[model samples]
Structures are given as C-alpha cells and as structure tokens.
Target chain A: MRAAARPGGKVTIAEVAARAGVSKGSVSLAMNDKPGVSAATREKVLKAARELGWLPNQAARSLSSAATQVSNIGLVIARPARMLGLEPFYMEFVSGIESVLVERSYSLLLRLVHDVDEEIGVLDGWGRSKQISGSIMVDFTVDDPRVAPIAALGLPVIAVGHPDLTGGLPSVWTDDGAAVTEAVRYLAALGHRRLARVGGPATLGHSMIRSEAFAKAVADLNLEPGRILPTDFSGEQGARATRALLASAQRPTAILYDNDIMAVAGLSVATEMGVSVPAELSLLAWDDSQLCRLTHPPLSAMSHDVFAFGAEVTRRLMDLIDHGDAEVGAVPTPVLVPRGTTARAH
Target chain B: MRAAARPGGKVTIAEVAARAGVSKGSVSLAMNDKPGVSAATREKVLKAARELGWLPNQAARSLSSAATQVSNIGLVIARPARMLGLEPFYMEFVSGIESVLVERSYSLLLRLVHDVDEEIGVLDGWGRSKQISGSIMVDFTVDDPRVAPIAALGLPVIAVGHPDLTGGLPSVWTDDGAAVTEAVRYLAALGHRRLARVGGPATLGHSMIRSEAFAKAVADLNLEPGRILPTDFSGEQGARATRALLASAQRPTAILYDNDIMAVAGLSVATEMGVSVPAELSLLAWDDSQLCRLTHPPLSAMSHDVFAFGAEVTRRLMDLIDHGDAEVGAVPTPVLVPRGTTARAH
Candidate 1:
C-alpha cells in the first residue's frame, strides 16, 4: 500500500530507523515507547516518524501473532464501583496501560461482570471466539474456579493477584499480608494492646491473607480472637461492624478497617455512637482511598500505590504476552500513611 | 451454520411467535426486550423461546442491513474525570449501561481522550472506517467543533451533556441550571450573602450553563461579583483555590465545589489549615460522589444519579446507531444531597 496524500501517511519502521540512523528493531522499540532506548532517541524517532507520516500495522500485527491473538486486552471487573466511581488508582493504572497501548495502537476492552462464573464464561468465550489477545485476572478466591476454566483454553493469561492462589500463571499482587502486620505493629507502637478489625470478604484471596496476618500478629501479642470481624468490604458492612464492636463488653481501643470505604463508614458510625477518633478510640484503614482525608479527623492508613501496582501489572502482562513467559513478580511493600485517625490509644 | 445442540436447535423468531400465537414483529419486540409488546405476549414469547432454547441473531440482522456493527457501545469521555479513577458515578453509570448491553448481547468500549478535537477525529474516523456502529458523546461545549464534523460522517451519536449544546442529537444530562439555582438559594437561605463557587472547566458546555445560573442566582440575591472561580475539576486545583479564597479577607462564608474530588480535597485543605467546617466555613459539591459520605463530616452536595444518566445515554446511542437519525431531548433533573459539610453561615 502507498502512503496517502493526507497529513498522516504510512511511515514504515525501516524509514523511521533510517531517519534516526538506527536499526529497524530499535525503531520498533522506540515507537512502542519501551524503555532502554533513551528518552532523547525515542523522541527523535517519533518526531521523524510523524514527519514521515507513519501508522503501525497494528491490526495486521495482531492477526499474525504466533498465538492467533486478537490484538487487544480484555479486563472483566467484578461489579461496577457505582458511587465509588473509578478511583484514582484505577485511572492511573489505566493511563499507564494506555500509554503503552496507544503507541502500539492496541485497545483495552473493559467490562463489568455481575458474577465470577459469568466472567469465567466471558473469558472462555472471548478467547475461543478470537475477540482478545490476552486477559487480565483480578479478585482471586481460594480454589479459584475461574483459573482452571481459563487455563483449559490454552489462552495466554496474566493474573493481577497473589501467585500462590493463581496456579503459577504470571501474577501481580500487593503485599497485603505484610501490610496487615505493619498495621498491627503501628498500632502496638502507639501503646494499644486490645484491637479490632473490620475486614473485606473472607472469600477474596487478599482478604484471607490479611486476615491470617492479623490473627498471627494478635496471637503473638496474646490478644483475644473475638475482636476480629470479617464482613464484605463495603461501607454498610463497615458501619454495622463498628456498631457491634463498640457494643461488645470487651470493646477494643483501636480499630482497623480493610479499605477506605469501610474506614469512612466506621468513622460515621463512631461519630453517631459518640466514640471519638484517636481520643476515646483509635482507627486505621487499608487501601488508602481519598476518603481518608475527607473525614473530620483524617484516617491513618496502610498505603500501597494501587495505581502504580495496577500499572506495574499491566506492563508485566504486556511483556509476558508478547515475549512468551517473561519473568513477572512485583515487590509487595506497604507504606504507612499516618494521618490523624490513630493516636497513643487514649 | 449448524446449531450447537444446546436444547431445541435454532428456534427462530418465527417459531417463538408461532408458539406464543403472535406475529414475528411481536416476537421481535419480545425477544429484543423492548417495550410495547404487551406483558402477556412478551412473557409467553420468552417462555416459548426458553423452552425451545433460542438466541437472537444480532449479526445476521446487521449483515442484512449492511451494518457491520461490532457488538459494543463506544463510550468516549474527556478530561480530569477520566484521569480520576472509576468514580462511583461512572462505575454505576457503566454498570447500568452494561446491564442493557449484556442483555442485548452487546459489549461496551470505554475510552478516555484529551480534548474535543481528538474526539471528533476519532468518531469521524471510526464511523468512516465502519469499525464502530455508533458512539456516545459527552461534555458538550458551545460551538463544539465536534458537532458538525461527526454529523457529516453520518455516524450515530448521543450526547450526555446540556441539551441545547448537543446539536439536536439525543442527549442525556442532569439539570445543571436547576441544580445551580437551588444551591445558590440554599446558601442564601442560610444567611450566606457572600458565596463563591469552584466550578468545572471553562470550555465545558455544562460549566458555562452552571456558571451563568450561578451569576443569575447571586445577582438576584444582590450579592457581590468575582465569586465564581471556574477550575479544571481537579482535586489539586480545588485545594489550591480553597487556599487562595480562605487566605483572603473577603473570602465567602460558604463555597461550592464542582465535583466530589474537589470537595474532598477542599475539605482536607480546610482541616489542614485548622478551619472548622460548618463552624467557620461551609462547603458543597456537585455530582454526589461517595467521597461526601466518607469524609469526617460528610459533604452536602447537589445530587443526581450519574449512573442512570450514563445508562440512559447508552440506550439512546444504541437505538440511534442501530435504528437511525437522533432522538434529541431533556433527561432528569438534579437533586440536592444534605450532608455534614454545609451549614448555616451564622
């Protein structure tokens, strides 16, 4: 095919490389915005390509891939966040993914699924129908049925969850287990012995990991088991859990909320019930959402860059899917966002 | 094509209507889940189809019409909201859109773009290329260069912003004019003669409408000028604006933020600056994000169901693209959410 007379025409990778005085492979790398090619070299290549009017043969490349790929990534999330909207983390992660995708002229196909089974079926069917290049897996549960079913299709898969639960596929997860321990240690340093926790759904793999860590940390300190309450990670459940904890005869002085939504809900319930934060009782949160800073007394949280985490996963997935089993592992470290929610335990 | 042998081989619309003792058109209405097929006839047709194990041939219909339509709705969004993660509004709106899409055997293609020009190019190209059957448009600006350009391509479009700005395409929007007036009236009722607002981007079609209403309402109440500060609808900008306003000697008693992120950011800044909310200052936000409830003292906001708004737009877009010309009109009106941030300016 010949280049069009219009502003942007087909500038081949060879022409780009020739203009930049580099190899075709180098031009390909620079055009795809991959690292190792210096920022200056990448810019020069892109500028040259634009001047030459180049568009990557994205559709053809996808069609000719070794695995009979579909040229796009499919992400099926469990339920829509609704009032929660796509959080900053999700946005940043998506931007990170798109940063790479747009360069390759690839698309990300996102969907909201009502159930795990439905998602499993969708993944299977889309793969079978050649509608996706690869899939992004999230919200894994113990003995995850989705993994087994998807694995059966021999589709290139990358999971965004703990590896232990993901059947050895390339996986990415935040260090929830270590993060829970850090939360306990942070509270302990503030002179709190008695503690309570409002956890997310016990079925989720990350939730279970964190719950176990909380127990082990408490057990090491010889604390009571009745203080831990597991509920679906939602604001309503958080409010209910807070009320029940506050009503208990052995009410703990410090409370840990699994996510920001629940922490905010706990904050409300505490206010309504007349239990002051970091005064009469101390509180903390996991998954530091912007909600933490919005409350009267801001919440201290176990913070991990969810956006970066998601971005990192997308990057690794692209690598593995493209290069066939690239090394994939992310450092699971948790940073403490010490806000006003926790104090020297009353 | 051979049937997969799931139940009764290919129980066509003819068979469904025959079983239900209705015409093929009635069966079409019933199977497509559209209104006006009568509840009795619809139920009977569905039951008969279920027993016979049939699925709709959307592809066949499209091919017959010379419409190589992909089974997905293209959702293109502009600016800061897209940068912010999945807010509950989009999550819920997308959820609502998806429910319809899935039931109709369609998928949703969500995209984020930088500006109107990029969008115009995308829509024009996609429509011309016949890659996407139709698109959902949002954030209408006055003299929107995008309007005539996309229309010329004859691509089906549905706007989800101000009706007047939509160029007669079917539109879905919350009544910003009414909502703004009510917000101003509420603040005036609370003895707030001096009120300032941090609104969305200047180029946005709805922002212009809201700003106009704000000015009108403020003047009607005989208030001062230079109180409306239009922002890019970002958390950082909102915080910065809040700081500048609060630092001034003539700062307003109550302030309104365009969206929940800005409200939350402003609230945080106030707390950091030792400002007492509802005591020293009152704050309100538009778009009723969950950030309101998550805050210490929840925010009071101009509330409306954005999810329903999105779904409504999606449905209209699908109809326009698949069925023909646009169905231009008004949608729902916005309401107020009374939360903890707004109080009497004593």
Candidate 2:
C-alpha cells in the first residue's frame, strides 16, 4: 500500500519513516509527540510526511499501543448556567454517566459553553491535547454544526440524539415523537378540547420533533391546536408562558409542559390566578422527576428513567471508544404516569 | 532556603545536578519528566538526588515553569447521585465555578463518589497522574478523611467550608451559624413559640453547625424548642420528613428547611395534610433557588448568591494554583427574604 501511494494510493507510516531515515519506533514516537524521540529527528519525520502528504490516520494513531490515555471522558453542554441550575435532566443524566464511569475508573470532564461554536472549540482543544479519551455530546439541534467538525477531528464521540440529528454519529435517544403523541392522545381522551404546550428552545431537535408530533396529534384528534410557547426551559419562562396562555381570550383548558420544572411552574401560575387544578385547567409534565410528586396535586407526568437512559448512552460511548463500532438504539418510550394533576376538562 | 535543609548545608537542584555530572537543565527536565533527557541520565539524577536527601520541594515543583499544567480543575463530590439530581445547590455552584473558569480557559473535571474513601482515592489518582492542576473539595462531613491525605499528597486544594471543617486548608464559606441564628430569631419575633427544622444530613459539617446554632437560638429566645429532623437532602426525604413532623402529636407551627427543594416539599406536604401556609404554619427555605418563587404562595428564603459563592471558591482555588497564597474568608451571610410562605403565626 505504501508503494502504491508513492504516486497515488494509501500512504503508510513506514514510507514516512523510510523517507526521513528514521526507525519505525522513532516515527511513531515523533508523530505522537512522545518523549523518547529527539527534536531534530521528529522534525525530519514530520517534514518527510508533509512532503509525501501522508497524514497519520487519526483512528489508527488513537489506537496505538503507546498512546497515553487520560482517565476522564468529556461532556460539553451549551446552555445558560441559570437554565442548567433548574434543569433536572442534565443532573440525572450526569449521575447515570458517573454510575458507569466510576467502575471503569474514569471521571467526567464537564464544561458549559454558550453555544455550539464554543462547544466545538472545547472539543477540538481536548482532542488535540489528548486530554479526554472520548466525549458524549448532547442537546443536538437540527443540522447540528458539531457533527462535521467532530468527525474531521476524529474525536471519539457518542451523540445523544436521533441518527439524523447526530449527523451519523453513534447515538442513544428516547422516542420523543411517540411520547408526545401518547401525551396528546391521553390529554385528548380526558375531554380536553383546547390544549397548549410549554416547549423547550425551538432550536433543539427533540423539541422540534415534539412540536411536529403535537401538531399531528391535535389534527388527528380534530381539536383546535393550541399555541406552542417555546422557552429556554427555565422556570421563569415557564411561568411567563403560562401567564400569557391563561390571559388570552382563547385560554387553553389543559397545558402540557416539556419538563417537570416547567410543569411545576405552570401549576403555580394556575393557582396564583385562582384557577383550580384538573377542574379549571389540567397540567401534564413531559419529563418526570421528584419535583413532579412534590407538587401540590402530585403532577401527572410522562415518566421514564433518565438515569438509566444516561447510563445507556455512556455504555454506547464506551463501545464506540473501544471497538470503533456502534449502533443507534432507542430507550423505552416515556409512558404516561397518571396522577392528580390531570382530570376531565371542565 | 535549600542550604538550610541539607545535612551540612542546603542541597538544591544544582547540587544534585553536580553530583550526577549533568547540566542543571537536564536535572530539571529529568525531575519533571519532560522531554530532552536520556533514560540513563534521568536515572542517574534520581539516584544522586536520593543519596543527597535532596527531595524536590513540592511547592517549588508545582510553581516551576516546566510543570505540565493540565488545563482542567478537579472537583470530587461524595453523595448519592439520586440526591444530587434534584439538589439545586451543586448546579448553581458549578455555574459560578464555570464563570471564572471560562475566563481562564479551564474546564472542570467532576466526579461523584459514594463516600469520602472513594473521593480520596479519585483525587490521589488524579494528583499522581497530573490530570488536574488543582481541585476544590465540597460537602465536608465531620472529621473529614480527605484533608490529611490531600495535604500529604501536596495537591493544591481549596475547601468550601468553615476553617474548622476545612482542616487548615484555605477556604471560602458562608456564615451558616449566623444565618441560622438570624432565621430562628426572625421566626421567634413573628409570634411563633414552637419551631422545627428539616435539616440536611447530620454528618455534614454545615448541618451540624446549623443544628448547634438552632439549639442555641432556641435557648436564647426561651421558646419551646422543636425537633430537627435530619435527612439526605432529597426532595422525597424532605417530603417524608415533613409528613412525619406534621403527623406528630406536638407539631411545630413554623418549619425551616435546609434547601429550597425540601422547603418546597414541606410546603406540598403541608397542603396535602390540609395545613395552611402562614395562617396555620409558616415555612422558610435555606439556599434559595428559583424553585422558591415557583411554589404556591412563594416560599420565604434565607437568600444568598450561591453562584457568587462558587465563583469565590474558584477564585481562591485559582489563587492557590498561581501564587500559593490564599486566606479563608466568608461570603455574604444569607439574609431573610420573606415571601408568602412566612408570616406572623396565627
């Protein structure tokens, strides 16, 4: 393959080593920036490789026996810290990741960024410095800008989204669309005619999927499709959205929140406005948490084990890092756990 | 300083280099495990240094220009993940830590352990491997096992506790004792004779301090003291504790919770049991969060800027890493933010 690459073909490390008049071991050490090789020799090897246009196969280099592995896996989240403080999803997810990581003697290197560009920069730096062996990426948006850069850099990554959203990266995701349908259908069956959703940021792929599914479910049920209020998934926004929806002339009789916190907030708003729960209005939470049960009426929620889901993603990430082969799979669809929050619309 | 530590005189890195018949530069490189030194030369330097009893000064080694600084800070939290999932304290604290870290281009390496033993092991490994430049330790229980081992390992650390709990490490803390006193006194002035606290785990240093302060305040005010129920700080545990307290024959008219989640839970339990807010019972929260405002009748809180507190700890950690000089100081004491949850007792 090296001979064929001389004109046009696969270029091997041996060709670079031979051209630089260095031993194969020296070439390997030089390429990896290991301590054993001399600076002049490393320069020669690099010069030769550059002349031959022979880039070390990133996957191959990462798998080299002498590669120094850092004992931490990277996760970069791009969200406002205020939002993260209240969001139970990330904390539960991180807990699940740690459950698997602890047994394997790995720590989690977590960073919060303002946006995807910063996330990409962080991952690239971590990859270049070999600071993290692999990373788990979440909060994938439609046409995510992260996928190509991650692939180009050859960083071992397991995205937490559907395959299409992840840009071909290995993923572990829940069936959000089906869950939304179930939630809508359940609310519809409870004699609710007008309904609305307090959704997450519109840019998030999962939120988009939920919105589209919500639209479809409403159409199928032949109910007036209520407005979808997009937010940054903060309780403040949840309360604000709830206030707006209730104040409108065409107020929603029942409201569905994207997560438990929002649902709790929406419930509080209803009470503050003197609206009786499940009688004057109905509330349903998308992601169930301990917060759901702690509320006044014990919110009915679309419940799933987020901790277990996080663990599953970590498991696939480990598989990707070790074998370079991974397949996408969905965790169990969120099921409706009916409680006191929902009742027949008045 | 080096001459003072020698048998006859101070034996510095220069003396070791002279004894090994190597350049001073080589000795520095060998000691730091940097490139540009042969294996045999490194061994010779090590032997000569050992024979001379010229141990490398850990502080000086850390400060050396050649030290390969890892661009990440370590944080080891010993707690159940389930508890961590709903607690708003850590997320707020972490966000504050990140506010400072992002400016310096540092990432946070977070790990959760079941107990202090595991925390110690994780930190030891990270220190040995030089995977973190420094660390911030939190949630110190009574007689923390981490302090001595961490100090012995010469790993830079900033503890987030009062001086007594920090075991002589530089610290950043809030005045929990003062805050508790203020809370008790405020409730007492509000015409409440019977009072109780839903405290955090009794093992935690802060919890113990708060408990002690609560006891003293009760004695000072000459009011009927109420029981302090210890919990794991989970919302479920909070709910359970509230239930137990409310069901007791001599229930307290006012309750103070260790965190907002617990306060929220207590409020829910009160509502569930047909207790009225402020009319029949008053509730107060420690460690205020957005959850407070989102609750029905908005909970009163001992409000402090937890994000700012976290940033302060990170600031001190950074100082410890850079100049090796930091003094323990308290952040602002939490102040009473009275909302709908607290009022004059009926």
Best-fitting candidate, scored by lDDT: 2
Q: Candidate 2 regions off by >4 Å?
A: A1-69, B1-69
In model 2, the clashing pairs are B2-B10, B3-B10
Q: What is the TM-score of each candidate against the true structure?
A: 0.77, 0.80
Candidate 2 lDDT by residue in tens digits, B1-346: 0001112225688899999999999988876657899978977876676556454554454334323456789998887666667788987888889888877868899988876756765665566556788999998877775665566556678888987887766677899999999999999999999999999989899999999999999999998977999999888889899999899999899999999989999999999899999799999998888889889899999998888888888988887788766656788899999999899987
Query: What fraction of the native alpha-carbon contacts across the interface, defined at 8 angstroms, is recovered by model 1?
Result: 0.16
Candidate 1 per-residue C-alpha lDDT over B1-346 given as tens digits, one digit per residue, 9 for 90 to 100: 1101112254467887788799999888765445778867866775665555454553444333332224656766665433545344555566567666766656666555665544554554344344456777777889675654454445567767775787645566677888899999998888887889898888888889989999999999887763777787667688899998899899788998888878888988898888899888999987775556766688899887676676677777766765664455667677877888888888
Alpha-carbon local distance difference test for all models: 0.69, 0.82
Instruction: List interface RMSDs for the candidates, in order.
Output: 11.2, 24.2
Candidate 2: interface RMSD in Å?
Answer: 24.2
- Given candidate 1, what's the lDDT at residue B232? 70
Docking class of 2: incorrect
Every model's DockQ: 0.14, 0.12
lDDT of 2 at B234: 86
Worst 10 residues of 2 chain B by lDDT: B1-10
